[model samples]
Target: MVQGRIEKLRFIAEEMQIAFHLATNLTDPFFARTIARHILVRAENLIAHARGLRRPLRDAGFDTNAFHTAKEAYATEFEEYFKVARHKIGAHVQDFDFGKRIELWNDIEIVKLSYFVDGAREIYEGLAALTVPGYVPYAVPAELSDPKIVEILHQIQRSLDARTWVEMGTDSLAMARGNTSAVLNTTPVHARAGQLALIRRWIALQLELRGKLAAYPAIARLFKERIVTDIVSFCDCLVTRPVAADALQAMDGLNKLVQAENQSSAAIDDFVAASHFETDLAATRRVRDKIGAHLEIDEAETLPMLLADLNAFDLDKALAFYDRVAAAFNKQCFAVLFLRMYAADGARLYGVTMGHSAVKPFAGVAEPPPAAPPALPLINDEQEYAKNLRRWLDGDENQKGTARDFFWKAFMGSDSIEDIKETEHFGSGTRYHSHQFRKAHQFLLDALSDGLSDFDFKGVLDLVMSCRGGAPYPLSEVLVRCAPHAPVFRQYLICHVLGEIGSEPHESVSDFFDAQAHSPTWAVRLEAVMARYKSFIKNEGVFRTNHKGQTKVEHDALVASMTQAMSPDERLICLLGFASVHTGPLAGVFTTPFNSNYTALQAELEMLILPLLNDDDANSKVAMLKQLIQTHDYVGVSVHIAINLNSGENHPLYAALVDACCRGTIIAASNNQASRHLAISYVMKKDHRFAFEIAGPLADRNPDWIDAQILVAQILGEIVGAEADARKRVSSIRSAYKLSPMQEAALAAVETEVQNRVTRQEE
Candidate 1:
């Protein structure tokens, strides 16, 4: 059912991207407005579908936590667009109030709309990848064969790729100058790979923009400048730096460092004219900053206001500008590429001409590479095996039997551990597919069986360790049955398999791990502890799936063994595993009478885990504490801490709670500042001790966090009563600080009440 929803969402999301493309790119205002309205409606629909898809995705055993967060953020930004573009003007309303006039929004706003569409597409694609076959490209279905459109698309991609180089090139140029500008400024090959990815995405968007629509010259001009600005920013990253302004110091410094730098041909100033670079970059920056969608235009003005200046967007002049800018960009790409080649060749400095020759093609218009002949014959055993596997998986059900038979025979025929490892099998189509090839447990067992006589224990162990999805039968039973007969492989299995053991159905299996818990090897013992905790969680309510048939008595025995022998760190894992089963964005989703039985156990586990915080390794503790605070039981946890503070039974781990609260408060504030403020108020009402602990940390940070301060003040007034001295301090604090009108209004009301109390006292 979830897969069906995800598939439906992907289809809708793909159509939305197409609508957005038509909306933004069409030169005809009437058609563009029509398409834009369609996009807005589609966006609203897509959001509703995405929200619906979330729960199903989570229940389908996919983690939707991070995806949901990203979706919410995208939805929020899209909502504002929906309000303005659709609700107010585009589709729903033809008229508006006198105060507001509907002017077509700038191209910059259109770009942002495109980003939202891409964001939605990304989420849908990611979900699809989890359950679909092969690469599902987010291809924008459009016809864009015009030369003008193709040229513009390439230009956009080249500029986007160049933007990545800017930051890296700037850093390299600075370091080069430090080394007297002689050193090659090589970046990692990974950086190039990353840049290529950006280029592909940019290509996708630009192609989408070239849908069957007339190009608007004004919008195109603006887009060109945006691209140029990005390219300039890359150049600027190299040139922009802190420098001494005083002439004497500048000259003196130049003599000391500049002279040495001038001896080398790699100096940035030698490659480009500083004055020209500065002029072009500054011009582009001004247009991007002042004219783009990020900044608001005056109410009376529109985008065409800039075109009133005759030379502002002259097509002829832009062409000339492009040539000069493109050349400079090419030179920069060459210089950076040369540095990389130089480094790779053991710092063999090719002369300056060699750098120019090599980098020239990157700067020019890139031509498509020649297409290779299709259907190359399989060249190796690995290639042949992979080909046959994919063909079988993709072929008919009847043909799949041939593939399965071939795979099994290959496994049985295998003699060495290496050959057994090389054996491939596709267990069933119901589970995994060509996109992700995970062999069945039976196939792995067969492969292991083939090599067991040759003492291929390592191969068996490797296969066991690779088990992410549990085996069809108990892995614990298989190990138990094999261990006594294969003593040579016992130690290897003992070390590796213990971590993979999710549940123990039998006493012998439980005893096997229980005895290993006391192993001399700390690593082996730690693995056993983790395996036991996993077993406990899976067998029990947490996850509520994948049961390991262990009775309460057996489960308690495992916990008892862990508590008696495992270290604090190991216990921390057990505590976290228990908490995670219950943790989520909302509480009470899985509430049953069974929860009451585990409440005491949960409390006891929290107590044991909390005190073990260390300055050296508090990352895990901090993370666990944050997760605990986010859980539905946060109110319970907070109340527990407040009770502890009230009784003056402050545990050493109380500081960790404070840290968790502070972090949670920051996240909560971003989502809802009122909720955070009210939380502070609630704690203050419970115990001033708890309230002050939270309020003190919040106060120490931003004074501008007036909501927090206002709540803190209100809480203080409740705690202290309306004393004259307290009123004076509040008045003094209000006057001393700068406050926004809203803050002042809130403070004024609080002060006026205090003044009233003071007057009554005087009367």
Candidate 2:
């Protein structure tokens, strides 16, 4: 029964955390899908362990502490796994962890109870194992495997609630680094090297035999071989004077290919003669005619068509085919003593394109040697390329005739795409013309101020980069796509990302970043903020009023947007954002954005918020408490809390703090940004207190709740402050968390007075 209950408890926890992300509006579905899958895997480990231990605790002399330690480790693993899971989920653990969160909005008392429940379970198991009937609870699993079990693992699910767990995931470190405790083993040196020199040498030698064939054409001509005669016949057939219909078609295609070459052929022919071969166009014509009849070459189509197909080789598809061919070669070569596996890769690409592989040695049919490789093409003269460039920039859609001509024109014209693909292009027609992003974006942007939608990321990106003139455009439209990391486009994309996340365009762009000004990455996160550093200082005084032109609804909308951005890494940025809320005057720095509240004391709030909430009655304490409550509205009496923490008495969230103590209700009655008032009521006996919650993307913001809690505690403490004999009084009212001697003494004194007063009243 206990085992089943524990299993059920695990399910509830896992699902609860998933639900919490929606509350902050930072739920990233991609991350959620990934984390949920991993949770299932880890849960299986716990189920496996439970299966191994059967017959319950009563049947064995079990050491429960050992199991408890393992379980504790398991819980730690859950927290660790959540570190990565949270990152994967697109938030940070600090933003979602329930333990930390409960401390913020709820109370530490609740987490304290959680600690108690965990401790009680451990103790009960050990004691029960030692003294009475038996059953041991399993580890707090970080993963859940079974679909049905996912519905039961509450702790495992809640384990992921830590906000950072969704953003920066914790790796499931092996209980220890891989096998350090085990004996060492090693492998062969050849395994480490990836390649064998002997294999390279063997392949090269086989190519050498083929390379020796380079003298074949000259030898055939010298001998007046059949190859020479066949070549003449083929040339004659192709050059027939009347220009047969097929011949006419061939001439036209040849004209286009040469035209497309745009005088590059002179350079190509010159390089070929100098680098790899000796050209004899008259002998070449004779050899070429005979080549068709001497060897079985495919000539069912015109020569240009065949050559074009050969040049447009698709390497990826070739490799795929080659894989199968390679396997076949090994199988064929295996039985031979000398296994020289044939690979046509290099020869098919750069060699003389002579591919006739016959296993049998030539008897009387011995072939002449092969010619050298084709001369690589190069554009030697910049001015010469101008002809093609003119054709490309001026050609009408109709004047572009022939596939080769169209392809050449389009390619040489594009600037950016041409750069990425390098100067060389197969043909102008290969690229998609209608998909031009520049024109598409101009059309879309003209139609809507927000820019295009329904386009993918690449499309939007291309349009932004191709803008005609220098100007800034709002990036909110693309924010949903290039989230978290700002898109890279001369840093303009960064501004868009910031604006999108910020959700409001400030009177000046500086205000947008200054808004998150408290983020850990604040001031540094967006360079634009620092860019306007001087300007901000100059106009600092008018900031509140500058942005004041925004309607209250708009201002509130902006604040909500800031909160959503901060929610993901609440711990990472909340302090930074809160601290920067009024972070103008910046103490002694050049005071451009002069903050009226800028005093050394307010600056010290950074130091105060990090430490205990109620610690300092120092100079800055008053500045911290200043905006917590405004008496004009009548809290009847006011309380305060910092948005920074749930502890500080001067917290900006005083309203929530007051509300938490009362009917536990917090109502932000007004939606107006400037005149907004949070009404709160905290009553103890016949007395009640009230306060308001001030909110914004303010750094280390003092939420009213944090101050409210501390305020109520102070009011409780002060009412009992006058008790006498403070130190030596209380020897009672003690249970846990050993109250110091002074607290005991003080409490004893207060208790005595209260009792005495009640007695007198009774008389």
Which candidate ranks first by TM-score, i.e. highest? 1
For residues 1-763, what per-residue lDDT tens digits would candidate 1 score against the true structure? Answer: 4544554455556656655554444433322433455455446656766787677667768777777887788789776656555543332222232123223222214555667678878777766546633325666544332356545545544543332111122222122111111322223322222222222222223334433223644334333433433333333333332346553212111112223433332334432432244444555555544332122123233323533432264333333333333333333334454323222211212111111111112112323532543332232345445544544546654344344444433433333332111122223422221111123323444444443534345544533444323431244444654554444335435434544444334455567667667777544554556555555544443434223332343445655757665555444444433343344221243323236535756666566645543413546544654465445344334434433443232543343343333323112222223245435535534565556555545543333344655655654554445355445535534633455788768767767766676677689
Highest lDDT model number: 1
Please list the residue runs of candidate 1 whose C-alpha ends up more than 4 Å from where it truly belongs after superposition.
1-148, 151-516, 519-527, 540-554, 567-594, 606-763
Would you list the C-alpha lDDT of every candidate in the order shown? 0.43, 0.29
lDDT of 2 by residue, 1-763 (tens): 3344233223323322222221112122212222232232223223333323333432555545555564555455444433333222112111123223222212111222233234324433443444433234444433222343333233333533332100111111111111111111111111101011112222232233223333433211212222222222222211222247664223221112223434222322222222111222243333333221121122243324433433343322322222222232222223222222221111111112222222111112324443554343222333423343333334543222221232222222332211111121223433322212222223233333333333333333333333211222232222322333433332333343333233222333444445334545422343333323323333332443466432222222333454454433232233222223232223234232333333432344334443434435574544444443221121211233333345444443443334322321111222222112232233322232232222111101211112222222322332333223222122212311144566545565546655665566579
Error of 1 at 414 (Å): 16
Displacement of residue 728 (Cα, Å) in model 1 is 39
| Residue 306 CA displacement from its true place in model 2, Å | 90
Error of 1 at 467 (Å): 9.0
Q: What is the lDDT of residue 14 in candidate 1?
A: 61
355 in model 2: Cα distance from truth in Å? 50
